[model samples]
Target chain A: MGLIAREIEAAGLPTVSMTSAWDITEAVAPPRAVYFHAPLGHQTGPAGEPDTQRDLVARALEAGVSIEQPGEIRALDLRFPDATGWEATAYTPEAIPMSPDGKPNRGAPREPRA
Target chain B: MARPADAVPYIERTRALYARQAPYRWVVHDLEHEPPPWTPIRSSLASSRVALISSGGVHREDQEPFHFRNDVSHREIPADTPASRLRVSHFGYDIRDAARDPGCVLPLRALRELVDRRVLGAIAGPALSFMGGIYSARLVRDDLAPRLRDLVLRQQADLAYLVPA
Candidate 1:
């Protein structure tokens, strides 16, 4: 999503990413972003909390325009409940063959030793 | 909203949302481009047109749902669409909060309020929503990103807020 933000900004538009994924936000480095320390699914604020959510959104919109630096991330202090309650929604990939040192081998097949 | 079934690995969970899933190791991309210079906000929010965008997998009830199967597609939601008529469908994170309050993920309601309160100039039309679990940069760069660019431009949207769920 930050990648897409970059593209949109590249198109001569100003973009601000109000995102919860700081690591990825830093990785993609959009023009302007406000790191909401909430949760993955909730970026504005806690669920069913409209006033707080609106406040956060208002702050973010202000940041979108007031921000001066490129790739700037203004970290907010809004903390959500612990994520320990959330379920793992990850999707795993296929396995790869490992080498003796426990490193996965990506090279071509080698001839058998005599 | 249903409770999360297990502890969420916030780190790995977000990483999987868009990172390439290499079988051996995590592959990170150095997306460091020459960051665009600081462009000042287009006057006041009450004057410049604002665009609302989200990565929360939101769409209109009548439109086709986000293609989580492909994961690279995006959807366009009309700005006038009410929050009650909107819905979310993404697998990256627990969608319970977003389901209960789409504003939690998209902030559409807040954006609309800004308009109503005269805090914003106007709400740009055809806001965007897309599945964010895309792992391929090529898909983002060459295809999906360009489509988003086109949307912003076509709408004549002066400022855009991208709320990534």
Candidate 2:
């Protein structure tokens, strides 16, 4: 997708890209509309979360159409501060491993699976 | 909404409603010359082939989830993930049913809308998906790039509209 961004633009059409991972987005530095979302795997918004989905789509469209100049880049300004808002109620971020090899072997009591 | 039993690799109809919001930034821009000289894209509501790359540590239930504990590890789901077998591993968004309708995030319907509006050609037949929590981007450029390149090639895509989770 990174390499294709330029070629796509070269074909005369603009592009809008998304990434929840800040590092990846920053590195690719795609040459089109880009958004750095807070949630992972939910850039388009949350599934079954209609409003969130619509908002993201609207923003992406806005990013694509908002471009006036030839080489303009816009990053969607969206954030979630509290869980009261659109927090992911499904998946959870695994705890960081304290081991040197990057494996989670802390022997922490596992939350009994449902 | 239940994710479809026969769906794409993406999560079903989930939505992202931002709680706080981020400050907009233009890290680069230069779209006049031949190669455009590192110009940044636009920032408003424009139209384009928006592809999504979600992190939420998603993976198929039948297969192993990507490294969720690592901050710099990631895996890409080809456009051919058994639409129905996809699932989210991260606890960021409620993607229960969204994997069934990946379009909710990739917006294949919206892409059709854009196509109807004369904005773009066509949505990439097989849009892409990813598992998040990757910290180091070196692998993205080196490893991820080639994999994505293959996807674009297989789909004959002109552009890649990304949606990161």
Candidate 3:
């Protein structure tokens, strides 16, 4: 996530990535980026949690607008009202293999379709 | 500016958790004491295609699941990764149905909607996905970046929306 942001930002496009994992976000630290305290797998807020989703998305869009220099990292101040802690929940990780047209042949090999 | 106390418990907890996990020490420590933001540039997506990547560690059946053996740490999947399908790999939210919808988690639908609304110039084909959980710092920096570079370039993606899972 961070690396892709770095490449995009390096390519001269301002980029901001929303990451739940501070380690990854801090390291990748694109020119403009934000970190969320949400768990991994749901950085854009709790999946279908509409209001939470709206707020996070807004923050991400805002980061792109507000950033002023290179390698900046901001923490988006949004959270799920019901989350007990970062450790209190579990989510199933799913695969999104690119369709025949979507695969990036030069990058990681497409995982075989199930 | 401030939010209600209940609205940010996760923020407070995440700070405490980061203290305990201390996972970000390396990156935080290495960054210039005060790095700044860069903006005001044109949307790179203006003339070129764009892509979106996620780290929720979501994947499909035939695709090998990210190494979940440790129960505590996992591998970093890069942006260009291709899964036969998608899933919701986290343990927090209960939006299972939305997870399957792909639009809910990956939001290609939202981007398309943005294009329809003219919020964006266009949609980039070849959205990307990553495993989202790896714990090792060396691998993420050294390993993942190169792969992401290749992915975006191949897609000819001028911009990318990286929504961490």
Candidate 4:
């Protein structure tokens, strides 16, 4: 996403990226970004929370205009509700159970490789 | 920016996880340049035509789902797409929450509400979406980025809001 932002910005369109991954954002360095500590799939906030989602959308646009420096990432103070220890669980292989053959058993079915 | 004391070192963790789980190493591109590309916002949110872009694998029910691995192609989701009509197909993160409420990832409903309240001027129809966590930075830079840039340019969007889930 940050790569897309850079390309769009280079083409004369301003972009503001909202990211949950701080390390990836730092590495990719989009022109402007608003960081949220929310979980990966819930970057806009929790599901069933319209108010929080609206607030986040508004805040991201505000950051689009207010951010002055290129590659500047303004970390929003907003926190996902009751989201404790999410970082520990996110993107970790250990969370998935291992099969008898020693293969990680990702319970959910994934799309077959094309 | 001040991160929380307990912020996870995702880079290191992901690197290690990929080593254990996948056949290949996972690496994020570390840009060494001092400054990234920049384009100033020419209009206020009340007047600018904003476009939404998400790396959350969001697509309309009628559109094709993104490939599970190394797929850099994107989908164009209409701005007025309802929450129920949206779907997610990505492997990098849990999709349960997003499946229940697409707004948590795509936020088309929230963006429309903003436009209705005059917080935004208009939504550039046909918002863009693609799967993130691709292994090749070259594909993203050379293929996906250029294609998405062209689409956003065609929309004449004054600015874009990107959400990476």
Candidate 5:
């Protein structure tokens, strides 16, 4: 999403991406992105909630035009009902396989935030 | 401007969610980049030709689904198409929310409403929709982005609103 948005902006059209992954967006640094703390599929807001969806989308668009610099992202300033649950299954330390060194085998998560 | 410090938790949350779903595992993307390119809107929002896009893998009911689990292919969705006529097929995110109300990700309804209220001049044309989980920058650069660029140009859109997964 980040790379694609950058490429589009580079082609001379302004673009903004709505994202559930602020970590990744921070790294790739698109022209503009709206960070949503909501779940992956609910970037605008919850399903069946038109007003919230409209508000968030409109805000992102407003940011796309009004924001002066490139590589900017504003967090979606609203709370959503179901933004959790990956905490349990994403990388349970106990559920991770054990390595040959007897330490928990785990893949790297997000890199340290810059 | 936002400091990187403020982004720590959401970044972790992003990596956690990705780790939960994807088969191949790696750290979240961490790279330095030049400032993104810029293009100011030439006209006011009320009279600008706006376009909408989404990485939610939405497509018309008769169109084929994005191919493969990790696809770089994209689909074209008409601006006036109803939300019920579209479907989601992305591999990266939970499709349940989008399936129930694609406006949550695609926001076509909102775009149209804005147009109706004269907040926008008009919808440019069909919006580009993609599965967007392609990890390779080369593929997105060589395949998907060009096509979308062409579509945006064809529509003469003054601005684009993209909801990426």
Candidate 6:
């Protein structure tokens, strides 16, 4: 994601990214970013929370405009609900479902329902 | 800003998780010397055309799903597509929340609402979606980035908002 942001920015388009993974964002170092300590797949906000999502998106765009330094990742002053407990279990082997080969099955397609 | 108290050590956890998979090793790209590209915003949010991009594997229900691994390809989802018509496919994280409310990742609906409220001027182009778990940074820099850049250019977007899952 950071790489793509950099490429787009290089092509003369301003870009701002919202990232859940600080480590990866730090490594790739996009032109601009807003860090969310939320869990993966919930970078914008919690599911079914429209107000929170809109607020975050607005703040991210604000950061894109106000940020002066390149590669700046401004951390949002917010937390996901149940953040502590979610962090404790996220990415753990026991928490991930395993396939028949004993590998994590996180990639399998689960189509969204309307 | 101080690090969030609830921040997770995702890098270490991901490394350990990949280790358990034995043959598959996950490594974050470390670009020590490369400076980030820069383009200053020349327009106000209320007047600029903005594009939405996500690395959350979101695609319209009728579009083909991204390949689970090393899939650098992207999907161009029309900006006006209903959230209910979207789906997600990816491996790096649990996608249940995204499937339930793509606003959690893609946030296309939120973008539209912003436009309606005049917080943003307009949707510049189709929202672009792609899988972000690709192990090869080369493919992302070479294949995926250029394509997305071209699309954003074609739309003449003044700025782009990216959401990475």
Q: Write the per-residue lDDT of candidate 5 for residues B1-165, one digit (tens) a residue.
A: 464343335445435544644443322343333666777667888888887778887777889877534477778898889987887765555566677788877888888888888877888888888886565566777877888887777788878777875
Question: What is the i-RMS of every prediction?
Answer: 10.8, 10.6, 8.1, 3.7, 7.3, 2.8
What global local distance difference test value does model 4 have? 0.79
Stretches of candidate 2 off by over 4 Å are A1-14, A19-28, A36-41, A65-114, B1-64, B68-84, B90-121
Per-residue error for B98 in candidate 5, Å, reads: 0.9
Q: Model 2 TM-score?
A: 0.51
Candidate 1 structure quality by residue, lDDT tens digits, B95-164: 6567767888877777777788888888888778887765567777789888888878888877888887
- Model 2, range B70-163, lDDT digits (tens) per residue? 3334455544455355554433333443455554444545455556655565555555545433333455545654565555555644445655
- What lDDT does the true structure give each of the candidates? 0.67, 0.44, 0.50, 0.79, 0.68, 0.80
DockQ, per model, reads: 0.24, 0.19, 0.18, 0.52, 0.31, 0.60
TM-score per prediction, in order, is 0.78, 0.51, 0.61, 0.89, 0.80, 0.90
Docking class of 1: acceptable
Winner on lDDT (1 vs 2): 1
- Tens digits of per-residue lDDT, candidate 4, B53-155, equal 8998888788888765678988988887788788888767777778778898898898899999999999987878998877777788788889999999999
lDDT of 5 at A60: 66
Task: Please write out the lDDT profile of model 1 over residues A1-114, one tens digit for every residue.
Answer: 777777787777877778665666655577788876664677887878778877788877786677787777786655565565333332222111222222333541221111
- The full ranking of all candidates by lDDT, starting with the best, is 6, 4, 5, 1, 3, 2
Clashes of 5: 0
lDDT of model 3, residue B162:
75
Per-residue CA lDDT of model 4 for A14-109, tens digit only, reads: 999998777778777888988888877888989999989999889877965799978777888788886567777767764423322235457743
Provide the TM-score of chain A alone for each candidate, in the order shown: 0.67, 0.56, 0.65, 0.81, 0.68, 0.81
The most accurate candidate by DockQ is: 6
- Candidate 6 residue spans exceeding 4 A from truth: A95-114, B20-32
Worst 10 residues of 1 chain B by lDDT: B1-10
The number of the candidate with the highest lDDT is 6
Separate clash counts for every candidate: 1, 82, 37, 0, 0, 0
